[model samples]
Target: MSIKKSPESWAPNADQDLGPVLILEPEEGKNFWQPQPANGHISVRISPDFLDVQTPFSLGTQTLPAGGYVREHSHPEHDEVLHFIRGTGKAVVDGEEHAIVPGKTIFVGRNRRHMFVNSSQDELHWVWFIQPNGLEHFFEEIGREMVVGGEDPTPFPRPENVLEIEARTAFAPQPADQRKPD
Candidate 1:
């Protein structure tokens, strides 16, 4: 049996009508994946620009090769959530380390230093969401778009305007002491 709701409950508002549904296939996203310089990792931004929503969050997927690690950093203005989909890794949040695997979820509060390191032989796959939006623009500005099925170009140096971008985004770099032993 179906139940009826009040007109206000079912009605679409202006805010809802302003956003359109977006469906991005994996193949379509692969073309936008950008590899991190000097790191065996790639990321595909999935939201913000994709849907152009007015929401406060952005989404993206990242694949980290075995032994790859993201340098520790923190967002002074936004919180981050990461959900692991494959492989194993270690997440250091505020200098505390936790082993992570498929189905594991992590919540990092704003201004907490965090980084991820792939420890398994295979790739680590995860989707990350950042609150208050805008981080995707930083990634786009710093990362080079990867060509599908083609060799990656030589890693480009960090953008000269990184500090400017960081100031605009409230992204703060942190010194990392978590590294896989040789």
Candidate 2:
């Protein structure tokens, strides 16, 4: 059965680009295998790939295996809001540690340092949304391409040129310790 498009649509995108997702059907978003340590996956839900930055914010969903974590990092040009939708975790935002649980929303301003660690027995899931439209591109650049229902790939490392990718994406992560206050 075919799903009908929403009666109203957002502005059209360039001919080659898909338009903003008014309704995301199954298998609609771009998915990728998250690099090792986290060893999970991310789905780019909405971004400039579909809509203009002036209107649509970038959005993605990520899942992390037990004991997985995201290293400390910062986005110099964009603010981020993460909604903890599943599992429990610990979030460090600018040196402050917070408990993460379902329904908890975390706001990280541009240039603030942060990290997340999953402390649950099950997979941890969250929605990563950012202002000005761009996070999805960063994820895509460092992530290995994967399709929904495909076999999961072996755990992998970040690209050797991850620093360059971070530069291009406005991410400003140094070694976690280096960024912490002395």
Candidate 3:
């Protein structure tokens, strides 16, 4: 998280490629999270430069392009606050798919298995807030925190996992999905 800059750094390409060039390989060292895509799930950390703040709770944006899917997964340590800024999608929690659209917000509690898919024609953009602070940093600290073979629990249904069943819930339903979540 280095913010050093030169006096002329912002002067319209005056020092192109001079300030910082970052390359993070999660396998190479600390302060990085290792990520792997499996089955229908794909996710990537928004790069250090893209991060607005590097401490406490981490804020980042992710995309689930049309036809893309995030396999069932859960956060054991932190609850997540997700706000969909664009497009449409469906989130599956407790074995149910709930429709999602622009302006929709969904809160998935810690350790709850959940998955999301873009079922619409456009790409889905959502900002994620990881609570209890520094979710990304913690992931980096533990080497690889989220992935197909990682220790984090998958949101998908697994006979051996024994995920606690909770009353499924949602923020609000899109006009298309008539049934409301309680």
Candidate 4:
């Protein structure tokens, strides 16, 4: 459904030439989840592909179950910001550990190795944004499909093609050095 521009209506400005503004609720975006171990779900709020126009950044929410953690990985070509919304956890960025709490924000530069660990028994929920695209597609490719309000999918192993997906999605190869991981 394309929005039509009328005398009173509006469209992308010529000077800006950017994607439309998006206002989304917590669960209003496409969601995906890890199968067994991580149990983390990514709900995409906005992206270039989602907005159908090239944008400078993408926004999403990340939920990590108690004991679940986002594995250490980095986007060698993009910067990222993570804001903790709820729950307790720790984020290790560039080998430095920091407490994850509501209202806390972390900025990770390109090629920085980082991961989140849910230390408490409660679930960890946070919002993540990445610039210049990629993370949204990465989550979609690596996680099992999850509908907005659908029941969780059955536990499953990470896709065999996950490494290839990561590579194409601009993730710094595992170990941050070796091109082909064993």
TM-score of each: 0.75, 0.82, 0.48, 0.82
lDDT (10s digit) by residue, model 4, range 5-43: 333235445554443555666556778877655776878
lDDT of 3 by residue, 93-166 (tens): 76677798889898988777677777777877777776654444433332333443555433333222122221
Model 3 stretches with alpha carbons more than 4 Å out:
1-55, 133-182
Model 1 TM-score, all chains together: 0.75
> Which residue pairs in candidate 3 collide?
32-140, 56-133, 56-134, 72-155, 72-156, 73-155
Tens-place lDDT per residue, model 1, 20-77, is: 4556666555333444432444454555555556666787787777776776778988
TM-score ranking, best first:
2, 4, 1, 3
- Computed on alpha carbons, the lDDT of every model, listed in order, comes to 0.69, 0.78, 0.52, 0.77
Deviation in Å, model 4, residue 177 alpha carbon: 9.3
Over 1-182, each residue of candidate 2 has an lDDT whose tens digit, in order, gives: 12333333432643434433355765678888878667788888776666444465788899998877887888888889999999998998888889999999999999998888888889899999888666787778888888666788848888899888888875876753743211
Q: For model 4, how many clashes?
A: 0
Candidate 3 lDDT (Cα, 0 to 1):
0.52
- Give candidate 3's error at residue 48 in angstroms: 11
Question: Pick by lDDT: which candidate is best?
Answer: 2
Model 3 residue 100 CA deviation in Å = 0.6
> Residue 15 in candidate 3 has what lDDT?
48
